[model samples]
Target chain A: MFFRVVLGMVLAVASCGAMAALQIEITGGINQGQAIAVLPFEQPAEVKVDVAAVVDADLMRSGKFSPLPRSGMPTGMAKDEELLKADAEVAVTGRVYKEGGAYQVEYRIVALKGADRGKLLGHFKGAAPLDLMRQAAHRVSDRVYETLTGQKGCFRTRIAYILRRDGAPFPYQLMTADYDGYNETAVLKSTQPLMTPSWSPDGRRLVYVSFEGRRPAIFVHDIFTRQRTRLASYPGLNSSPSWSPDGSKIAMTLSKDGQPDIYYYDLGSKQLVRVTQNQAIDTEPTWSADSRSLYFTSERGGKAQIYRHDFATGKNERVTYQGKMNLSARSIPGSNAIIVITQQNGYRVARMDVDGSIYMLTTSSLDESPSVAPNGSMVIYATVYNGRKGLAIVSADGRFKANLPSSSGEISSPTWGPALDK
Target chain B: MMLMAVAAAMSIAGCSTTSGSGAGAEGYDGQGVVTGIDSDGAMTVGDPNEVQTYNGPESLREKNTIYFNFDSDQILDAYVGTMQSHAQFLRNNPDAKIVIEGHTDERGTPEYNIALGERRARSVARYMQNLGVDVGQLSIVSYGEEKPADPTHSEAAWSKNRRAVINY
Candidate 1:
C-alpha cells in the first residue's frame, strides 16, 4: 500500500516540490479517550501561567478527550447550565487563589449524563504548591478517565520521544515529557540516532535501541541512578525492544541466527530465548499482559498483518483480517484490544479486538505507532502533522482529537510511559 | 587480483555481514570496506554471474545505495532509476538477488531508525517485489545508523551515510 502511494506521491511531489508535513502523531492508550471540556480554570489571580490549559493539554495527550476550546464556548463557563449544555460529556470548574507566596487550586468535574438525574460522578478538591498544579490537574484527569472507562487513566503517565536539534553533532536527543506534552526534558543526546524507546513496567527505567557503539544494541537506562547498560547487539538486527509486563524480560527482534524473528532476553538471568521460529519478517513484538504470548506482524500470511505466537503451545495464528498491511500492534493496558497500523485505505492506526477486527482511529493519511495509556482508555502514537514530527491523540472509538506539533524536529517510535506512581 | 576477487565474490553473493571477522583480512574495518576498496556500485571485477561464496570475485561489484534525509524513511526519486536498474538486474538474472540494507544519518533515535531503515529497505524491497522481482531473493537489514557510509562526524557526511545499500 505504501508503494502504491509512492507513485501518487511522485506526482504530488512533482506538483508541489514542498509537500508539507500534513499528518499528526499521537501515542497513548485505547480506552478511546473521552471528549470532556475544561472551561479555562478561572484564573482570577495574577498567575501569568495558564494551568488549566496545561491540564487540558495533559488530558488531550492521554488520547482521551477532545477538550472544547474556551474560545468556542457560546457562553461563559460559570453557569453550570451552559457548561452542561456545551454537549461535552464532562466539564471542569476550578479557581486559583494566592496564599502567602503559594497557589491553592480547587477544582470539580461534572458528568453531563447524570445532570438530568441530579447525580454528580466527580467532586474533587485539592490544594498544593503552585508548581504542582500540573500534577494536580493530571490527578483530576486520572480520576475523570477512571470514572468514564471504569479502568485507571494514564494522565499521570510519561512519554519518551526523540528531539533532533539543528547544530548538535548528534541531533538525536531522547526526552521525557508528561502525557500532555509538558515538562519535556532531554535525557540523552548525540549526533547518532537514539531509537526504539521503551519504559520499564515500574516506570523507573527506560530501555531503547541506540547506535552509540556504531551498531544497534538495546540499552537500559536507570532514571534514578543515571546509569545505562547495553542489553544486546545480536550481530545483525538488534532493535524493536519491548519490556515484559513483569519487568523481568525484554522481547526484541534479532537476526543473528539468520532471518528476522522474535527473541526474549531475561534481565536477571542474562539468557536469550528464541520465541518466533519464522523465516519471514517478524519484528516489533509486544507481550500480552500475562506474558504467556507474543504479538507481532509477519508477512508469512501473504502480507504483513498482526499475528500471535503463544509461548506454551508455540502456535502462531493470524489475528488481523481487516487489512492486508498491519505493522504496529500495541495491546491495550488491561484489555484484549490491540491498536495497530492497518492499511485499508491508507496508513493509519486502527484498533482490533482480541479476535482481530479493524477499527480505524485516524482518518488521516499517515498514522503509525499506536501506544496506549496505562488505562487503555487512550491511544497516543506518533504521526506526522503538517510535515513536522507532531503528536495526535484519539479516543478509543476514534472520535476525540488534538494535534501537538513539536516546534523542534521529527518525532517517532513514541512509547507511552506507565503510570508515574513512583 | 585474488584479494579483489574475494571482495568481488562477496558483493556478487550480496552478503551484507554485520561482522567482518570472517573476511580473514587482518585490518578489515567494519565500515564494509573489508580491506582497501568499497565493494558496491558500477565497477565489476570478478564473475558477475556467480551467486554465492564467502569471498568470491563478485564482491568487487559496487553496491547501489540510496541515501535519505535525517529521520525519514521515505524513498526519494533520485533513487527510483537506481532501484529500476536493480529491479531489471534481479529480473534478468533470476538467480541474482538484492538485499536492501536501510541506514539513517546519525540524527535521530537508533531504534526508530532501525525501524525507519527497515521501513526504507522494505519500501524498496516491496517496490521491487511489486515490480515483479521475486521476494525470495530479496532480504532486508536495517543497520539504523550503525553502519554509516562516511565515518566522519559532519552533517554533510552523515547525510551521505544515511542510505540503504543494495547488495548482491
Candidate 2:
C-alpha cells in the first residue's frame, strides 16, 4: 500500500524537479490565491537546478500565491502593464552568477500597481554554490514572503522526526531534514523504540526517549557533535522530554514515584522538580513562550484535556473544553494560541486561543504530535494515511493542508527545529 | 459493562476506532512466542521473530497473557483461572523471575498510553500478589503503544495489542 502510493506520487512529482523532494499533495487551500510572478532566473550552465521555479513552487504551495507561469510572463522584464494583463500583482526577478568559484544570487521584487514600470519593492541577495540551489531558492522565497506578508518566513528551518522500519537493524531512526523534507539525514539509530523528539531552543540539541536500556530512558543528543547524554532513567518510565523555552530545563513525565506525573529536569543542577502531584495522568509538558506557565495534557478531568500550570502560583487549570480528549499541545512561538491534537472528528489538530476559541486544522481522522514552526506559520503533525503513519502539514489558519509522506515505515513525533538565522 | 461504557464513551468523543478484545491472529493463541529458556525451568516470551525455543510447557505460554478492553485495565473474568494458574506456577518455582510487560493499543497519546500500560501491568502484578505469588518474583515494564501484537489499526488488532504478558 505504501509503495504503490509512493510510485503514483513519484510519477506526479516527475514534473516538479529532478530529485524527489517531499511530494506535497495539498488537500485544501484558499480558492483564489494572491497573484505573484517568479521570472526564470538567469543562471550559468553550472547551476543545474531551477531557482526561480523553486521559489515559485514554495509560494504556490504556501496557499498564499498563484504564481504566473513563466510562458505567460513578459519577454524580458515584466512592466506594470504586462503584469496587470497577466493578472500578476507582484513579480520576482533574479539572477544567479558565479564569482571566484562561488555563486551569488540577487532578486528584485516589483510591486506592479498602475504605473508602466512597476516600482521595486525590495532587493534580496544570497551567496552559495550552484549545488545549494534549494537553500538559495529558500532564501529568495523567505525574502519574498516577508516583503508580502510582513511576517518572518520559516523556509530555512529544520524539522526532526522518527522513522520506524520493522525489519531494519535500527528499527527506530532519528532524522533531520529541511522544513520541506529535503536533505534528510539520519542523526541516530537504535534497536529500541525512539520517540517524542523535542528540540532545544538553540536547535543544536534534541532531547528524546531512547529505549536502548531495555526500558524507556530520556537521552539528550547533540546534532552536530553526535554525542549523547542520558538525562533521565529513574526506575520506571522516563519519557516525553520537552525542552523549556530558555534551554535550562526539560519538562518530562516520570513514574519513579509509582505514578506518571510532570517533572522538570534542571540542566544545571540535574535535579528533578516535581510539578504536578495529582493522582491522574499528567504528561506531555510544553512551556509557554514566556516560560512562566506550562501547557500539558492531563486526565485529571476524567479524560484527556489540555491544562495550563503557572509556576509562580502553583495553580493549574483546565484550558480545553470543546474536545473530550485533547493531547500533545504545543505553544506557537510568540503567539497566545497553542496547536493541540484535539478529539474532534477522530483526533484532528487544532489551534486554540487562551480564551478558548478553536480553529480545526486537519481533515484526517488520526492526527498527533503537532509541532509549530519557529515563525508560527505552519503546524506539522503525524497522521495515519492508509493506516500507515506519516507527517502532514497545515498552515496556522487551517486553510492549507499538505502531506509529507516518507517512502516507507511509520513517522512520529515531528519536532520543527528553531529558525536558522541568515 | 462499565468498561464497555467507558470504551463507548471514548469512541463517541470521536477519539479513536472501535474497542475490541481477544487475539485476532490465526494459529496464535494467548500463548506468546518463546523468546528463550530462562535460568529457571520457565521460558521467556517475546516477539515471534526473537523466539529461540519451543521446548517450554505450552500451558505456561497459553496462560501467561491477559488481554484488556480499550483504555480500560480491568482484567476480564475469563482470565481469572489463567492468572491463578500463573500465580501457582510462580509459587511452585521459587527461583523463577518473571517480567510483566504492559502494552496498549495505538489509540491514545504515547505518554498516556505508557501510564495506562503501567497501570494495567501493576494491576496484574497486584492481582498475582493477592493470589500468593511472591512480589519479588515479578518485575514490570510498559511498552506503551510502541510494540503491538497486531500492527493494523482495526479494533481486532487493538484488542490484541492492549495486553499484559508475563515473561520468565
Candidate 3:
C-alpha cells in the first residue's frame, strides 16, 4: 500500500534558441518540507548569476525545504524574529560583491523559534571566479542544508549519463554535468551506444559499457584527464562496473566463462575474482556502502530479483520477494536501503528497506536505472516524459519530484558521481 | 493468407535448391540480391548490390528478424522453419558471416535488459548451430532496449521490439 502525494507545479523553463543542455523542472509539490526563506543576496550589477536563487533552487530540489517566494520575503536582512513572523523556521541571508578578480560570497543560516532562536546556525565565506560563481552558491546551499537537515548536501556533485541523438553522425555521447544539470560537457562520443556509467569512489574516473567495437566492452575513463582504458573486453559481455566504497575493487558482470556472473576486479592486484557461479543471468552489480557485499540482479529463481553476495561467507542469498521482477538494486549511500526497479503496475523505481518493505518513489510507468545521490536524499533515474525519453529526479521519501529533460534527443543510463574532494 | 504465402514460398524454395535456377521466386530478382520484407509484409530492397548471395527461399530471407514473447527467449515454433532456412543457407555458403543482434522492450532495467538480449541472441545462435550452421560464421551482440524497432509504448510496439535480428 502506498500513498500518492499531490503533484506540484511543472516549472517548464523554455530553452533559449538551440540550447541542448538539460533543463531542470520541479514537477512535484512539497508534502512535509520545512518552510524557509532564502533572502535575495545583496550584490553589485556586475554579478551575472543570481547567487541566492541558485541556493534557493538547490534547497528546494532536495525536497527537504520549501523556500519562500522572494516577493513575500521581508525587505533586507530580516532578523530571526522577523523570519518567524513570516512563518519561516529558518532564514538564509547572503551578500555577494567583487573582491579583486574573484567574487566574494558570505552567507549565514539563522535559526528561528527554537531553543537556538536568534542564533547563527552556520556562517560561511568563500570566493570563486566569475565562471564558478554558481558552484560557490551551491556551497552556501550545502552549508545551510546540512545545518538544518542533518544530512550532507549533494548539490555540488556531478552526474554522468548517455545522450543519444536520433540521427547524428555520432549519436551517443557520455556527458557529465552539475547536480542541477548545468555545465554540461561530453566526456566521450561514439557512433555506437554507451550504457551503465558507474563513478569511481574518488569521483575521478567512470567505468561504463560501450559498443564501439560492435560488441559490449567496459572502459574506465578518467574524467579530468580525458584518458580512457579498456577495462574488460572479454569475448562475451563485460558490463555493469561498480566501484567499491573503499576504492580498492570494482564489481562487474562478465560472461567470458559462461552465463553472466558477478566478478570483482581488484585495482591493486589487477586480478578478477568470480563471485557468483549460478547458471542464470547475473548482472548489474552494485556494492554495499561498507564494501562487505555486493547486491546484483539475478534470474536464478526464474524471475529477476536482487541477490546479495557476502565476501566473508562467499554465499549468495536472495534479497527481494515483493515484486515479480526486481532488478538494478543500487544501495543507498550510508544505509542498507536500496533503490531498485520493481514491476508493479509497470516498471517503477522503489526503495526496498532491509526488512523487505517497498516504498514506491516514482509513479511513472517505465522508470529504470535508479541512482542514489551521495547523501541518499534524492534518486535520479531515466523515464519517459510526454512520450519522449528523459531523466527524472525524485526525493527518497517520494515527497518531491522533478524532471531533467534534454533540449533535444533522449538521455538514459544516468549515474550520480560520488562526492568529490574540494 | 500468411500460411498460404509461406507454403508457396517453401515449395519455391524446394524448387530453387533442387533446380538451381529459382530466380523466378517472388521478391528475388535472380541477380543474387534478396529483398527485405518489412513488418507489413512489403518487400523492399535498399540496394541490390548490398544484399549477399542468399540461396534460401525469399520467405526465409524475409524472416531474418524473429519476434519473442515478453521476458522469454525461447524460440517460438513459428520461427523454426525460418531458423532452418538460415541455417541451411549458412551451411551451404561456408564463408558467409552473420551477426545475431538481440533486443528487448523498454520495460526493465537497461543492464538487465542487456543480459536478456544476450540470452535471446544466444538462444538463436544455439538453434542455428544445432541446425548445422558453423559456429565460426556467427557472432552475437545485444543492443538491449536501447535500439527499438518500434519506439511506441504500446503492446503492439513492444511485441515488435522484443526480437533478434539475423544480419547477413
Give the interface RMSD of each candidate: 16.2, 14.4, 15.5
- By how many angstroms RMSD does model 3 differ from the true structure? 10.9
* lDDT for position A242 in model 3: 88
- Superposed by TM-score, candidate 1 places the C-alpha of residue A349 at a distance from the truth, in angstroms, of 0.7
**Residue A418 CA error for candidate 2 (Å)?**
0.4
State the DockQ, from 0 to 1, for candidate 2. Answer: 0.11
Per-residue lDDT of candidate 1, residues A1-422 (tens digit): 01111101111111110112222233333224565777777655545446566566656655546666666653223566666676667777776776677667766677776534224666666565666666766776677667765767667778887654433323456777776566665565543557778899988888887755445678887866656677887666787889988888999988787667888999899899998876666788888878788888776776677789888897988888887577777787778888888776656878888665677777765566677777676677666566544566777666455565665456666778877663
**lDDT (tens digit, per residue) of candidate 2 on A1-422:** 01111212232222221113456665666334678878888788777767887787677656677677676554334455654555578888878887887888887888875673478788877688766787888988988999998888778888898877665434566778787777666676554677889999899999998765567888887877755677888888788899987888899999888678899989899788999888888888998877788988888889989999998899998899987788888888878889988777687899998789888877777787888888887888888876788888888877667787766668887888887786
Please give the CA lDDT of all the candidate structures.
0.64, 0.75, 0.78
Interface RMSD after interface superposition, model 2? 14.4
- At residue A180, what lDDT does model 3 achieve? 73
Stretches off by above 4 angstroms in model 1 are A1-37, A42-46, A55-91, A98-102, A111-120, B1-101, B104-141, B144-163, B166-168
Chain B structural similarity (TM-score) per candidate? 0.63, 0.67, 0.65
Ranked by DockQ, top first: 3, 2, 1
Name the TM-score of candidate 3.
0.86
- lDDT for B77 (candidate 3): 97
Candidate number of the best TM-score: 3
TM-score of each: 0.67, 0.85, 0.86
